[model samples]
Target: MIGSGIGAPEKYRKVVVEKLGYVTGLQLSLRENLFDAAQNFDDLAKVSSELRLLASCLIKFAKDLRLLSSGPEAGFPYRE
Candidate 1:
């Protein structure tokens, strides 16, 4: 749905790619933080919450990107 809908419009396709890149960068940063937090278990709770938030955001970003990439001829793997 998204691929056909957004692909038909170049602007929407560009926006989706930009958004995906932004979220991917954030996920990388969050992964680095997890590594840093490993040495300071005292703040485990906060670190865990941050990790979860990042993961959720990353998942959403990926799903959206996938949707945007799906061609109208192809069946959608997700619904929004």
Candidate 2:
């Protein structure tokens, strides 16, 4: 999406990829411990909530970039 959306430079894109990797790791850990709390579910739920909060920001960023790449025409993908 980065390549087809904003044409982010390779170096900057690499940084985004690295950060996404961290997000993946956190997601996996939360999944593994999702039910470990059983009753309270405090820690796992907090981590999940925080991840989702961060995801909202990323979602907005992606949407804005998509709109920018699309300009006034939303009929087709930018790269095509």
Candidate 3:
């Protein structure tokens, strides 16, 4: 059986005292992809837009909170 994956050895070379005990492994390369099928990006675009909106809202809320609790004589000062 042949195996292939991320960790699987793709290509290499080694030597041993042949004609005693040996086995051979070979791999063939075929590059004949004239055109890869088109992939839709609409879903990705929508998710990116959603993330941008959420990030923008969170950033604005954080800025507002910082402004509210900033200077001692400004928005709201913490008494200690």
User: Which candidate should be chosen as best, given TM-score against the real structure?
Assistant: 3
Candidate 1 positional error at 1, Å = 52
**TM-score on alpha carbons, each prediction:** 0.39, 0.40, 0.42
- In model 1, which runs have C-alpha deviations exceeding 4 angstroms? 1-42, 73-80
In the order shown, the candidates' Cα RMSDs to the true structure are 21.5, 18.7, 14.6
Model 2 residue 57 lDDT score: 96
lDDT of 2 by residue, 1-80 (tens): 21142355656655665777797774321122223434465766899999999999999998888777774467345574
**After TM-score superposition, what is the CA distance of residue 32 in candidate 1 from its true location, in Å?**
25
Per-residue error at 23 for model 1, in Å? 31
* TM-score-best of 1 and 3: 3
Local distance difference test, per candidate?
0.61, 0.59, 0.51
- The candidate, 2 or 3, that scores higher on TM-score is 3
Rank by lDDT, highest first. 1, 2, 3
Ranking by TM-score: 3, 2, 1
Least accurate 10 contiguous residues by lDDT in model 1: 26-35
